[model samples]
Target: MTSLELQRTNLPEGLEELLGPKGLLTGEEAREYGRDFMGEVDNAPLAVLRPETTEQVAEALRLCTEHGLSVIPQGGRTGLTGAGVPSRPDHEVILCLARMNKVRWLDEKNHAMAVDAGCILADVQKAAADANRLFPLSYGAEGSCQIGGSISTNAGGTAVLRYGNTRDLILGLEVVLADGTVLDMMRALRKDNTGIDLKQLFIGSEGILGVVTGAVLKLYPAVAERECALLAFPSLPAVMKSFAIARESTNDRLSAFEMMPQNGITLACNRVPDVVDPVEGDYPWYALLEVSASKEGSGLFEMLEGLIERLMEEGLVVDGTVSSNEGQRAQLWRIREALVEAHNDMPHLLKHDVSVPISDMADFIETAIEKVQAIAPDAMLIAFGHVGDGNVHFNICHDLDTPDGSLATRHKEVTWAVYDLVQEYRGSFSAEHGVGSMKRDALRRYRSEAELAVMEKLKTALDPQGLLNPGKVI
Candidate 1:
C-alpha cells in the first residue's frame, strides 16, 4: 500500500465503528471537506468525522488524542480564511459539525436562543423571526455559513454598526477541548460577572483552542420600520461628513452606513444582472444608508427623506435615491453583493480585510490609494466596506484587460504596503477574518512579542499537545 493509504488505514482504531459508516468519511468523500470556501487551501485530510451530537464530538476528540492525531474543527466552511480545513495532506482529520445542526431552544422573553454550532445562520435568523424577535448577524454568506464559524471568526457584517460583531451577539458557548473535556458554559444571561469569561477565549480563536459544539445567541426586538437610501458623494470627505450628520440626526436608528467606491459600483452594474446604479451621474463615492426602528410608524421614511434633503442642501450628497418598499431596498443592497461577485473570479486578486479608527477612515483610504498606485498604477482598486465600523475590504487586482499573471509578482509588495500603513494608523491587519494559516505571518509580524507570548501560553494551557488545528493562528 502507498504511504497515504497506510496513513488513512491507521485512523484511530474503532473510530469508523464508533461513528458508523455515514459519520466517518474517507477517500474521495473525505477530500470534499479538505478545502475552504475560497478554494485557496486544498489539502486532503486522512478522514472527515461528521459527529451528530456533542457527545460524539467529545468521544471522537478523545480517540484522536489517544492516537496522537491532530484535529481540525470545521463548520459550514464558508470562511474566507483557511481556518476550517486541514493544512497538511494526510496529516490531520477534519471534525465537521454540519451533522449536529439543531435549534435547541428559543426564549423570547429572555431574548435569547440556543443552537447547535452547525446550525445555518439563516435558519437561526428565521427561528428568531418566528419568535417575533431579531437575530441581526447577517451577511452575504448567511445562507451557507454556520453560526459556529461566525463565532469562531467573530464575524463583522454590515449590521455591525447597530448591533455588534458575532462576539457581542453570543451570550454563551459550549466548547470541547483538545483532550475531549466538555466545557459547558452555556448560560443565556446577559449580566454574568462570574469569575472569568471563559467563552471569550475561543470566540475568535479559530478552533486553535477548542471546538465549539453549541452557542447561546442574544436576540433583539424585530424591526418594525426601516428606510434605505443610496446616496452619492463628490468626495470621500463628503461621504464621511454625511455619515456623521446622519448618525447624529437619525435618533440612533442608523443601522448601516456602507461606503462603496465608483469602480466597485461600475463593476457590479456591468457584470451582475439586475444590479444597476441607483443614482445618476458618475460620483467618486457612494454610501448605502439604512435606518431601522423597532416601533411601528416611526416615520423612518420621512426621517430619511429629511436627512437626504439636508445633506443635499449642504452639498454633502450630490445625488440620492430612497427605497419606497422592500423590493426597492433589496435592489439597492444588491449593488453591494454584486460588487463582491463581480471580481471573485478575477486573477491574482489580493483581498485585505483590515480596520482602522473611524476618524481616520477617509484619510487612510486616500493615502492608501496613493501608495497602491505607486506600486502598481495599472491595478484596479475595489475598496468598499462598513464605514461605520471602519472595516475596509481593500481588494486589489489587475485591470480586466491585463494579462492573467501580471499582478502575481507584486502581490506581496502591495499587501505589505497596505498592512504597514494600517499598522502606522494603529489598525488591525486581520479585522473580521481570523488569523488562519494564511494570516499567521501577519499575526506574528503585527502582534507584539509579549502579546504573542500570552497567546502562546493560553494555547499551551488549553491545547498543550498542539494537536488541535496545528499551524493555525498562533
Candidate 2:
C-alpha cells in the first residue's frame, strides 16, 4: 500500500461534509502542497485536505492526532520561510485553511476585527477600511498571504515604523490545539491582565504547537491627513539626521521612514517598467518618508514643509519633493514596493529580513555592507526597509541580466557572513519572518541550548505525538 493508504485514519461520522471534491485533494493533487513560498523545500505530501469550517478543522486534527498522522497548516504559500510546508512525504498531510475565510465580525466601536485564520491579509485590510478603520498588517504578499501564517510569522512591514508588527497588533486568538481541543479566547478588550496572555504564545510560534482557526485583531483610527515625500541624502548619516529631525519636529506624526540605496532605485527603474527614478540627480541614499495625522489639527503639508526646511537647513536632505497630491504619494510608496520586484529579477540576490536595536541600525548596515563589498566587489547591495523599526530588507543583488535562481546559492554563503555580524551585534537572523524549516538549523545553532530545550519541551508538551506542523520552528 502507498503512504496514503497506510496513512488513512478513522474519521468521525459526518466529518467529510465540510469539504467538496476540490477541497479533499489527493494523489497527484497533493503534490504541490508540500513546498512553500521560496521553493526551498522539496517534500511532497500524501494528501492535501481543505476544510471550509473551524469545526471541520477540529475534527480533522482530532482524527490526525488520534492516528498519529502529522498535519501541516498552510496559509497563502507565500512565506519566504517554509513554516507552512510539509517535511515528509508519507507521514504528513496538508490541512489547507484557505476555505475557512469568513470574517466573523468587525467591531468598530471597540476598534477590533475578528476573522477566520484563512482570511487573506489584503481582504482583512479592505474590510477594516470599509468600516473606516485601519488594520495595518501589510507587505508585498498582502494580496494573497493569509492572516494565519502572517500571525505565525509575526510579520513586520512598511508601516511598522508607526503601527508595530503582527505581534503588537493582535488582541486575541481562537486556536485549535494539536490534540484538537478548541480554545476560543477571542476577546476584544485590551486591558485584560487577567491571568497570562495566552494568545501571545500562538502569535509567533509558526503554528508548531497548534492551528489558529480565528483571530481578534486590533485596529487603529482612520488616517485623516497624510503626506509623503522622497528625499535624497548624500550619506546614510545625513539620512539618519533627517529622520531624527523629522521625529522631533513632527511630534510622532511620522508614519513611515524607509531607507533605500541609490542602486536599488536604478534597478527598479531598469527592471520594472513605468517605475521612474524620483530624484533628478544621483544621491547615495534616499528616504521614502510619509507622515499621517489622525485628528487633522495640523496640516500634513505644513508639517512636511517645516521638517524639510529644517532638514535642508541642516544639510541633511540634499534634494527632496513633498507630494502635492495623493497620486504623487502613491507613486512614492510604489517605488518602495516595486523596487523589490525588480530586485527579484536581478540574479544572485541574498535576502535578509532582519532587525537590530534602532540605535545600532546605521552602524550595523554600514559595517555589514562594507564587509559584503570586500568579499563581492561587484556585489550591488540594494538596501531598503522600515528603518524606524530597525528592520532592513538588506538585499545583495548581483547583475540583473543573468536571471537564474541557481546563482542565489552564492548569496546564501554571503548570508552566513552577514548573520555572523548580526549575532555579534545582538541582532536576529530571522526578524520579521519566523524560523520555519529554512532556518531551523540556524535557529538550533544560534539559540542557546537551554532555549532550544525549552522550545522542544513546549513543543512536546503541546504536541505530545508531534503531529502538528512537525519539523518546523524547533
Candidate 3:
C-alpha cells in the first residue's frame, strides 16, 4: 500500500489538532530525516513527525499504531547502523524527538538526574559537572548524539571499563510501547529488587521495542584528579598485557584506555588538522590510558607512573608519554578523536565495530588483520579504539589512489571476509553500533535460531501490532 494511503486509511482523526501544523512535515522536508550519520545507504520516509512532549510522542505513536503505519524512531541520526533511517519506501513515518530536549530535574544527593530523551549527551555531562558530579557517558558523538539514542543502543564508550555502558548508567526509563501505551519506569532508586526489570527490554532494543522519551540516569562523584598517558606497545598482545598491570596498579583508577596502531595514528595526524603526534619514537602499537580520582589526595599520577614502570619492566610497553596538564592531555586525545575524520576522504573504508573476550582481543585483531590482508592486500588498515572494553574499530580503508569504482565496490567483499572471521571467535560484528537497517541482514545470519526465537517472543508480547520503529534492531 502507498504510505499516504495506509496512514490516511488507518490513522484516526484528532491527532493533527494535538500536533498542529508546526509538528508535521511532508515531501522534501521529510527527506533529510530519512538518512543516518554515514550515508552508507539512502532511504526515505513518507512523513516526519516532531513531537515536543512525551504525551505528544505517545499520541503520535497511538495514531501510528491505529494506522498500521511502520514507524522509525530518530534521535540525532548519528548512529552508524542506519537504524534511524526507514528501510521500506511505503507505510513508514519517521518520528523524531529532537524537540523534546529538556532536563526534568536533578537529585544531587542520590547521584541521579532525570532528563528528556532529546538532551544531548555532552549537555548532560556538562550539567552533571555543574552540579559537582560526573556523568561519564561520553563518545565521539557526544556533541550531537542524544541521550535516548545512547540508551536505546546501550552505547559503550571509552570509560565503559570503569563506568559501564549506557544500560548500567540508566536507573530508569520512560518508554512508549507499540500500542502507544506509556511505560513509566522512571525511578532513581539504586537498589530496588523490583519484579522483572522491564527497562532491559527497551535498552539496547534500538527502538524496536519502544520509543524512549525520558530517563533517570545514575551519576557519579566528580573526578578531581586525573592522569593521562600514551604508551607504545609492540603488538596487540603487549597492549593487553600492559592493561592487566595497569589495572592491578594505582588501585584500578583506570577510567579510559584506548589502543591504536602507529599507522592509524599517522593517518589521524595527516588527515585531521590540529591533531599532532606527541611522541617521537617509532612503535607499531600505542595505547592512551586515563585514570581519574574523586579527590585531590588520590596520588593518581604516581600510581600511573608505577603502572607504567611495572609494565615497562615486564617489556609490555616500549615507550610512554605522561601528560602533565589538562591541555596536553586534551591534545593527546585529539589524535584519537581525529581518527574518523582522518579517513573521511579515504575510499572504500570498511569500518567494523567488533568485540570478543578481553583475553582474546590480541589474537582476534591479529587474525582479523591477516584475513583482511589476504583478501585485500592494498587496503590501508587503520584499526583502533576502546581496547579496555575489547571493542575495536577495525577500519579497512581502500587507498585513495586506488583505481576508480573498484575500491568502492569491494566494501561488501572485505566486510564479509572480516565479519566471517570475527564470528569464528564468537565476537559481535556490531558492538556499540546497533543493527540498524544496514546490519539487520547480518544479524539474521549471525544470531542463533534459539536466540532469535526469544527475541521474536518479546517482540510479539510488547509490539503485537509491530507498528513502533518497525524496520529497526530486529
Query: Each prediction's Cα lDDT score?
Result: 0.92, 0.83, 0.85
Candidate closest to the true structure, highest lDDT = 1
Which model, 1 or 3, shows the larger lDDT?
1
Greater-TM-score candidate between 1 and 2 = 1
- For model 2, residues 84-153, the per-residue Cα lDDT tens digits are 8887665677888998898899999999999999999999999998998999778889998899988888
Instruction: Put down candidate 3 lDDT per residue, 1-474, tens digits, no spaces.
Output: 865455444445666677778787766677888777787756767778888999999888888788777888888989888888788764588888888899999999999999999999999999999999999999999999999999989999889989999999999999998688899999998888969999988999989898999999999999999989999987778899888777777576899889888988888887788888888888999999999999997888788888888888888888879999999999988888887788866877677898888888989889888887777777788889998898899988876667655435677888888788889888899889988777877888899999999998999898898776776667
TM-score, model 2 to reference: 0.94
After superposition, the stretches of candidate 1 with alpha carbons farther than 4 Å from their true spots are 1-8, 404-406
Candidate 2 wrongly placed segments (more than 4 Å): 1-22, 401-413
TM-scores, each model vs. reference: 0.98, 0.94, 0.95
Candidate 3: stretches off by over 4 Å: 1-12, 404-410
RMSD of each: 1.3, 2.5, 2.4
lDDT ranking from best candidate downward = 1, 3, 2
Each model's number of backbone clashes? 0, 0, 0
